[model samples]
Target: MHVVTTPTGQIGRQVVEGLLRAGEPVRVIVRDPSGLSAEVRERVEVVRGSHRELDACMEAFAGADTLFWVVPPTPRADSVVGYYEDSTRAACRAIGARGVKRVVTVSTAGHGIETNAGHLSASLAKDRMIEETGVSFRALQATAFMENLLWQTEAIRHQGAFFWPQPADRVLPVVATRDIAAKATELLLNASWDGRGGVPVVSPDALTPDGMARVVSEVLERPVGYRQLSLDAYREAMIGHGASEAWAQGLVDMAVAQNDGAYDEHHRTAVPSPTGFRQWCEEVLRPAFLA
Candidate 1:
């Protein structure tokens, strides 16, 4: 059986659907089964509890050969790294106890240069904790997700502008979550590959924030502008939106690391995934903005 954690999330939802399409037996660990569609609820075995609970994971991992793991965001936590460790500690123990054969996990692209990267550093640390379990692991090392723009849909729709903490002209790799889910599903289904490694899931286009604005404008047929915010302002904005101080600071640090070329090493060597910036903007962002 294939076990999926965070099955209700953007990426994990797609992973679950992909597996179901292939007629694979699937199990999911979710806090609220109601978050799942009725069709999905009827299709897969649901273990109702947080994946961070050892008993829950042990229950969900039972008779499961492959696992799809994605850490759900905890923006209210006091410490970002501590949240990640707390979330993964139970799964690590459960993996050993269940004797799961393979693990496909969501991880960030900035592997080596994660100093003060906040979320990036935490994700890398999560990867290490999982790897130590010695299961056949594939870390889907993803860059900035284009879907993150969805968070600003209201601002973009009302003001025709988007804001970020990175320079307007700095080129960076961004990916679509669909591509990440596809990669995760593929890895989870195949049983031949062994050993721990990272698969970079980056889109073909490495566009600057300005270039992305242009694409958004062209796709939506409206003039949209990109504005760079200071790190302090960004942190304050996140905090103002109800995130904890540490979580907001973690976002600021992640933006700083991105601006400092954290993902450059992986981008330089990655075989680009299928999604392109324009395609994602046209298909995903355009619909989101109109909605």
Candidate 2:
């Protein structure tokens, strides 16, 4: 059995779909099975439970050969690092106990490039804990997701500009989550590789926030521009978006790390995924904005 966690999330859902399409025996651990579409429901065995719970994961992981693990976002957590560590610890224990052989987990771009990088650091730490379980593992290290831009759709449509905490001229490697899912599905379905390593999923061209805005403007046929919001303002905006104070501060720290070249390792070794920023803007962002 191939097990998946957070199977209804953005990347996880795609991973599940890709696995099912390949005619793999799949089981999903979800808190609410109702969230899955009817087609998905009829296809896979559902173990209804949260990944955060150790017993739940143990039950879901039983008889599983490979596991696709994606930690769902916890914006309201009191401590970002604590939440990641705690949940990963649970999964590790479950994996060891259930004798699951392989795992492919969603991780951030910079592994050793930066320390104290809030979310990135936390994800790397999670990777280490998962490794300690002695399961064959692969970390799908993804850069900034293009889907992040969806949060600014209203601002782009109304004010003709979108805002970010980074410098307008600073280029960052970004990936579409679908590409991450596709690569992950390949790994989960095939048991060819062994041991632990990282796969950097990035686009061929790195884009500055300004460059992204220009592409968006061209694609949407509007005069959209990039505006650099102050870090203080960015933190405030994160809180306003329902993130806890600690979580918002963690995001601010992550932005600082990004600006400070934390993702240089990923940029140096990035193998281009098929989707670029412009294609994503045209195919994904455009439709979501218009809708």
Candidate 3:
């Protein structure tokens, strides 16, 4: 059996779909099965429980061949990666006991310092814990998600410009979550995988924030500008959007690193994801922008 955590999410749902299409016996771990869409619930065997419970997690994952694990976002937390670390520890302990041998985890793109990269910290914690389970594992180290553009929608609507913490010209590798899910699904369904794959599934192409706005303008046939905000401006903007000051600053920090080309690891030119940001924008985002 193949089990997926966070299956209702944008990427997880696709993974589940891919697995089902591949004729794999499917199980999904969800907190509230009743809340799941009828189409999705009908597609798989549901393992209803929270991952925070160690024994519950192990039982839910029992007899599974491979696990698609992801820690969903919690923007309200005080500590940067503490929540992710704790949750992953629980999952690792349970998976360790259950003798499940293969795990595919979502990890951040960079291998930088802890506080400098909170997203990186979350994945690093998971990588450390899961690998020790003696499971043959593949940790997908992916770039900034293209869906992050959704965060700037308000600015795009109100100001005719997209505002962000990073400079408009700083190029960062960004991948659609759809692509991440597809690649991850491929890896998980392959039956045999090399040990500890740190696959940096990046965009076949990279773009700057302002360049993205230009594409948006072209695709939507309306002028949209890009504005790079100061750290203070970013903090206030996040606050305006109902985020805590520290959390807001932490985001600002990520953007700052991006501006410095920190998460821009494009060395694996041989390794490429099939879907790029432009295709994703034209297909998925353009309709939302037009609407």
Candidate 4:
């Protein structure tokens, strides 16, 4: 049986779908079972309670041949570092105790790179720790999610511009979430024991703010422009929106890193997915942009 920690998240849902397609029995770790899709809710057994506690979650993981581990951090958590460190450590400990052989994880590339322990640093730190769990693991290193554009929707409606953190022409690697999901699912379903190490899942193309603007404008037939904010401007804007000072500043700093190529390079050859930016625009972002 396969056990999935986040059966409802963007990538996690796809992983479950992939397993179901193969007619494999699966289990999901859930704090509450009601959120699962009826198909999954009915077919899969739920191991209730938070994964933050090691023993309970490990018990939930027992007897699973493979596990899909994902953590969606809470922005307003009191201690961000401990939240990740503890939760991820718990996952690793459980996987070890349970002797689950194959593990697939979704993680970021730049986080492993030297830099921001303030924010990026802790994520990279924890990712390294998770990799040491001794399971046959594939940690997907990906770029900024294209879905982050959704954060700009209300602004696009009111301002006719995207107030991004990087410079207008700053090219950052951006990949579709569906592609990330697909790649993750492919790894989980294969279970071929390829005996490989970390896998980097990147899109065919890396796009810039201007590049993104061009796509959006062409797709939506609107005058959408890119406006990159200064670090001070970014800090003030985020703090004004109620983010704690440290949280707001760290986010701005990370954006600067992305713009300067601090998070670029160190990628793998593409394993192409059915979707691309334009198709994403035509299908998802276009209607939202038009709306």
Candidate 5:
């Protein structure tokens, strides 16, 4: 049996679909079963509760050989790292108790290079916690997700621009969430690999913010631009959008770390993932913008 957490999320949903398509028996731990698609509801075993709860994890992980883990975000968290530990603490215990053999988790790139990098640091700590359980683990160390730009759809639609704290000229590695899910699905299905390691799921694009803007402009058939926001402005913007002060500050720190080349080491050795920036913009962003 294969178990998935956050089954309704962007990547998790795709992972679940891939597993089902492969004829694997799947189970999912979800806060709301209603969030799952009708097809997913009909197909997989649903353990309705937060994966952070030991009871929920224990129930869902029973008789499961492989597990797909993704820590859901908590934007209002008072302490970013504390929230990650709290969220994964139960699953760590459950993984050992339930005897789930293989584990696949969505994690960030920048494992060794990032310190105090808010969300990135917290994610790495989660990876360590899971590794301590001694289950065969594969950390899908992904770069910035292309889907993250979907959050700026309105800005791109109305203002013909997008914003970020990163420098316009600094090339950043990015990947489509579907590509990440595909990699996870492949690992989950094989069950042949053992031990622990990080898999880099970085795309081939060497695009800076300016380069990304140019791609968007071409795809959208308009003069789209990229604007660099000050760190203070970025933090305040996050807070204004309902994130806690610590969470907002953590985002700022993550941006600072990325700017300082947290993912540089991994990017250097990465075998290019399939999706290109222009391809993603054309397929994903263009439709979202037009909608």
Candidate 6:
């Protein structure tokens, strides 16, 4: 049996589709099954509960040979790292008890080069917790997702500009979530050799904010600009959006760490995913912006 957590998430839904297309028997651990599409529900076995719960994990993991694990984001959690560690605790115990053969997880780049990188640090910590189980694991370490740009669509449409905490000139590596899902599906279905390691999924061309603006400009047929928002302002914005104080602060720290070249190592070594900034902007961002 193949068990996939967070099956309705952006990446998890794609992973489930890929596994189903390959004719693999799949099970999904979800807190609410009604949120899933009827097509998806009919195709896979559903274990209705959150992966963070011990009983849910134990039940979903039983008799499963491969597991697709992803930590759902908790923006309002009091402690970012604590939330991650608490959730991972149940998964580690469940994996050990079930003796699952292969585990594939969504993680970030800059594993060793960074510590205390807010969400990145929490994700790396989650990797370590899973590795301790001695189960075969593959961590798909990706940079920021191109889909993240969708969040700025309204600003881009109304003001012809968007803001981020990172320097406007810094060359940032990013990947498409589809590529991340494809890679995860490949690892989950193959049952190949893997002790414990990371696969960095990045695009071939690095993009600066100014460069991103150029692509958006060309795609939308209107000039768009990038502005560097102060980290203090970004933190305030996050908090205003309902994130806890600690979570907001962690995001500020993450921006600072990225600016310091945390993703540089993996971007240089890893083979790039096919989607580029221009392609994603044209295909994904353009429609959303128009919508």
Global lDDT of each candidate = 0.92, 0.89, 0.77, 0.74, 0.92, 0.90
Residue-wise C-alpha lDDT for candidate 1, range 1-291, written one tens digit per residue: 999998999999999999999999999998899999999999999999999999999999988899999889988999999999999999999999999999999999985555588999999889999999999999999999999999998988888899999999999689999999999999988989999999998888979999999999999999999999999999999999999999999999898889989898888889999889999988998887787
Using TM-score as the measure, name the better of candidate 3 and candidate 5: 5
Cα lDDT tens digits for candidate 6, 42-153: 9999988889999999999999999999998889999888988998999999999998888999999874534778989988889899999999999999998888889898
In model 1, residue pairs whose N, Cα or C atoms come closer than 3 Å (at least 3 residues apart or on different chains), thus clashing, are: none
Query: Across residues 1-291, which tens digit of lDDT does each residue of candidate 5 receive?
Result: 999998999999999999999999999998889999998899999998999999999999888999999988889999998998899999999999999999999999874544688889998889999999999999999988999899998998889899999999999778999999999999999968999999999988889999999999999999999999999999999999999999999899889888988888788898988889899998999898888
TM-score against native, each model: 0.98, 0.97, 0.93, 0.89, 0.98, 0.97
- lDDT-best of 1 and 4: 1
In candidate 2 the C-alpha lDDT for residue 275 amounts to: 94
For TM-score, candidate 3 versus 6, the one ahead is 6
Question: Which runs of model 6 end up more than 4 angstroms from their true locations?
Answer: 111-114
Q: How close is candidate 4 to the true structure, as a TM-score?
A: 0.89
lDDT of 1 at 170: 96
**Tens-digit lDDT string for candidate 4 (1-291):** 888877887778878888788788888888878889888888887888777778666777888888887777565555555556767888888888888878777776663345553455556656777667767877777667778887798887788888877877666677777887777777777767744366666666667788888888888788788988888998898778777766676677667666666556543344644566777888888777667
Q: Would you give me the overall lDDT of model 3?
A: 0.77
Clashes of 3: 0
Candidate 3 residue lDDT tens string, 1-291? 888988888788889888888888888888988766787688788877877778668877888888889988766767656777777877888787776778998887764535565456556776888888788898887888888887666667778887767777777678889888988898888877757767777877767787888888887677998887898888887778777665676677776666666665552353778886678878877777767
Query: What's the C-alpha lDDT at position 262 in model 2?
Result: 77
User: What would the TM-score be for candidate 5 when compared with the true structure?
Assistant: 0.98
Backbone clashes in model 2, listed as residue pairs: none
Clashes of each: 0, 0, 0, 2, 0, 0
Mark the 10 consecutive residues where model 4 has the least summed lDDT: 111-120
